[model samples]
Target: MKNKVTAALIASAMLGCLGTGVYAGSNLQEIKAYLNPGIKFKVDGQPVQLTNSSGAVITPIVYDNNTYLPVRSISNLLGVTVNFDGKSNTVELGEQTEGVSIAKGFDSSYHTKDPKVTIYNGKDYKDVFFDNGSGTRGSSFMLYPEGKYQKLYIQIAAIGEDLKEFTIQDSDTDTVLKKQDVRVEDGLVTIEADISGVKALYVHGDAKSGGSVFIPLTTSYYK
Candidate 1:
């Protein structure tokens, strides 16, 4: 009887260890450490992660009093496929189970030689610095609709003597939406557009000149 009780206790302890990490009590945190910022988490049908500015995998984020991991690394570890569609401006992470459903990554911010707020969806996995492996100064984002917002917003650092102007247009259309001269002082300038029913959006701003941004719209997204 004594030997059986001891074996049962040992088994119970091992089972508890299986659900937790060495340093952390929560297994989710360990899983999240591998995910990219802005990739939503759904384990056993519950939301669990959020993205902060592009931080190194070593750097941890604390939100709602809980720490989270990056979505990029974690999902891949879970045997999920992650992909980006530049032509469609989409980033997607496949579902864990079979049949391959994109659970997140739509409108998720991506890096390019030139980046823009590129229609963020799942999570706003945006980085603070606009540098995308290149020294070129540009930015991009992909935004998902949380409420009643269809319009997109852009903000450029206002700086001294920097020629600032932006060209907004639809990539699918020959028509140019608007091109305006911008005066950026103190290293900041902000631009807003009322994109009601735009199918595709293209922007080129001369933080002096030369860049590309593509934004797509869904019918139910903007009202």
Candidate 2:
């Protein structure tokens, strides 16, 4: 007696859980759902725990003989990122254009050397990197694409009340691929670079008044 559930319904439920007022539609219907706490999940024959982003445990929901799982939890189990764009009312799975996070393939050697490089999450952004200011110039970091990605899409902005300049350069040739100056008031500036055939990238930021630079993780993707 498995029954198909609409994405709208799932989204509605998620929003309700989040205490958001957004509704999927006016034709919403209510159904009795039972929480099955005894159920377990496994991936590739290995057991896995189900939890939301808050680390709260989640269980399968049984409704009309059909089982439903939290989309975010299931996506996380499969090594996928789930994002909801409230403005567009859409759910995005994985990176846009079949891309992955530059953070995923970050060079580990620089981790100890560059303490200013940090992964950050905020109310407006998720899984992003913040280049905390260093000296008169802003912070910088390196990422290894390994020639697997053809394009890189990112949003950059000044973190605090200051203006900042950003540059993306080819690590091998030191060739500047893209440069932009962003202000905190201007918001996140989108940058698209043709990273075709490039192996490594050096991202640099220079601030006017010693402020940090922001690069979103969920929105930035390499394809």
Candidate 3:
């Protein structure tokens, strides 16, 4: 009976020692190394949409209070083309060129002689031609491009402090591409439109006393 009690005590002591080692605090420094949550990204004051390797859209995650963005998406948004070679696992980024300026490259005609490139809101603008005609009559402007362009970036705003309605149309087909009423109180109004296969664009405004101003920003097309 005495030998049996001694064996039982030894077993209980071994179990206590093993339990202490098993329940010991883990190394928090080592654990923190693996905890990378993620960052955020934006383009042109807009949040960038992320896509995974399988071409599925994913949302960005925040890690350590920093925003992370997908490199490919941000690069593309900034006008850099990304190409991947799967066979050799190589990636290529195309060169970015200076975009063509629409205001300098195209010819414009307007009825009002007040429309001229001048300093407005601390920047030079080929300002809009005004139509002060009675009975809410709108004015129009014509632009003739020397070459074809796929995209057109324009900044338009009201002449006064009020909102103004403006429309863009394909002069050849007379198809309305976009129409919107914009106010310039906050900042300069801006838009990016796909003007593919369009030779000429007609900018028109709603029947109003003060005309909406149009400023051509940039044009992009393949060579």
Best by TM-score: 2
- Candidate 1 residues lying further than 4 Å off, grouped into runs, are 1-149, 158-161, 207-223
Write the residue-wise lDDT of candidate 2 on 1-223 in tens digits: 0111233344435432321234675657887888889988676678989787678888777877767766666655554435566767765554445668766755432222232343333344534566554556655778776554556887777766564457888999998988877777877778888665467899876765557767766677786
lDDT of 3 by residue, 174-207 (tens): 9887777766574566665555446688877765
Better of 1 and 2 by TM-score: 2
Top-lDDT candidate index: 2
Instruction: Assess the local accuracy of residue 7 in candidate 3 as a C-alpha lDDT between 0 and 100.
Output: 36
Instruction: List, residue by residue over 123-150, the lDDT tens digit for candidate 1.
Output: 2324322312223344333333221122
Better of 1 and 2 by lDDT: 2
Per-model lDDT: 0.36, 0.63, 0.47
**Cα RMSDs, all models:** 20.7, 14.9, 22.6
TM-scores, one per candidate: 0.30, 0.47, 0.43
Q: Which window of ten consecutive residues has the lowest lDDT sum in model 2?
A: 1-10
Model 2's C-alpha root-mean-square deviation from the true structure amounts to 14.9
lDDT of 1 at 186: 34
Ranking by TM-score: 2, 3, 1
Assess candidate 2 and give its TM-score to the true structure: 0.47
